[model samples]
Each structure stands twice: as structure tokens, then as C-alpha cells.
Target: MTSRRTFLFKTLPAAGITLALARHVLAADPELAESDPDAMKLAYAADASKVDKTRNPTWATGQRCDTCELFNAPDGGDLGACSLFKGKMVRAAGWCNQYVP
Candidate 1:
């Protein structure tokens, strides 16, 4: 009979691979949190450039989600999580009225 140690050794690699793949899948497709009700109230935009200055004149240039204190983007990624969005990810270049340096 196979010992517990031997069984674990044989299955550990497979388990690790499965976990890694799952993580990658999740990281690749974060939910669109910006669409949430709270975000909508804040007038969050996926791209700061797309924000209508006419509609929101208070928004100034050079403000971006990636630079905001609430932004949570991974290195080298264009999308990241935000505290306001909860489960969704926002564009690195996105903007909103809640932006803070």
C-alpha cells in the first residue's frame, strides 16, 4: 500500500498546478465593479480621457484611477481593483469624482 507521504508527494504537483491555473483565470477576468450602483453614483469612467468635462467640470486633468489612493492595480496591468467597486476591476486610466491624490 502507498504511504500517506508518498501519496501526498505524488498529488502535490497536480494540486499546485490546479491552484495556479485557477488564480490566473480569476486574475485575467475581474468583474466590472465600476458598473455597480455605488460607482455609477460617483460617475466612474473606465478611462479618464472619456470623462465628459462638460458634464463634470469639477474633474480636472491628470487624475487617473491608477494614481488614486483607492486604486489597486497589479504591476504591468491596465486594470485593477478599487475599494469603491468591491469585486470589480477598474481601468488604470479611468477617472471619477472620488479621485484623491
Candidate 2:
């Protein structure tokens, strides 16, 4: 008969490995950018209020990439989709006073 200690020793490594792999599998996929429009809209709204001096100091001065309603992030980049324009991408580096988040 197998000893309890031996069984635990054999199973512990497997369990640890399984948990590690599960963490990797469950981690957020970097490829899933701008997958949800509603979430992105909310995010934009949240960041919009902040003044981006680097881009624009005032609402009239700066233009947010997402706020322009024409900015769209590329499929795999940190950028987001624009509501006004279609099939175009915007830069995360770009900013405007209209930025929500």
C-alpha cells in the first residue's frame, strides 16, 4: 500500500503545476483590446474629466483621442475605438480635454 506522505508528495507537485497553469489560462488576454464598447465608453467617460496638459490645457486647447469621436485604437494596441469614425485607430498617447479616464 502507498504511504499517505508519499501520495501527498506526488500529488502536491501536480496540484501546484495545475494551479500555476490555471492562473496563466485565466489571466486577461492582451489581444482582447476594446472588446466591449460599453466598457470602453465608461472608461472614456471616467478619464474625460481629467485635464491633459501634455495634450491640451483647456477643453478648447486640447483634444482627446477618444473624445474626438473619430479616434479608434488599433486592435492589439493600448488604444481604443472612436465612436465617430469607423475602421480607424487612435493612439493612447494622444489626449484631449474630453478624455474621460
Highest-scoring model, TM-score:
1
Candidate 1, residues 17-85: lDDT per residue as tens digits?
999999998777465655678778999888788899998887888999888999887674888888877
Candidate 2 residue 98 C-alpha distance from true site, Å? 16
RMSD of each: 3.8, 10.8
Clashes of 1: 1
Output the number of the lDDT-best candidate.
1
TM-score of each: 0.71, 0.34
Error of 2 at 46 (Å): 26
Query: Model 1, residue 18: displacement in angstroms?
Result: 2.5
Model 1: CA > 4 A from native: 1-12, 27-29, 33-35
lDDT of each: 0.84, 0.50
Instruction: Give lDDT tens digits, candidate 2, residues 13-95.
Output: 99999999999777633322233473354333223446434544455434456445556555545556555324433455454
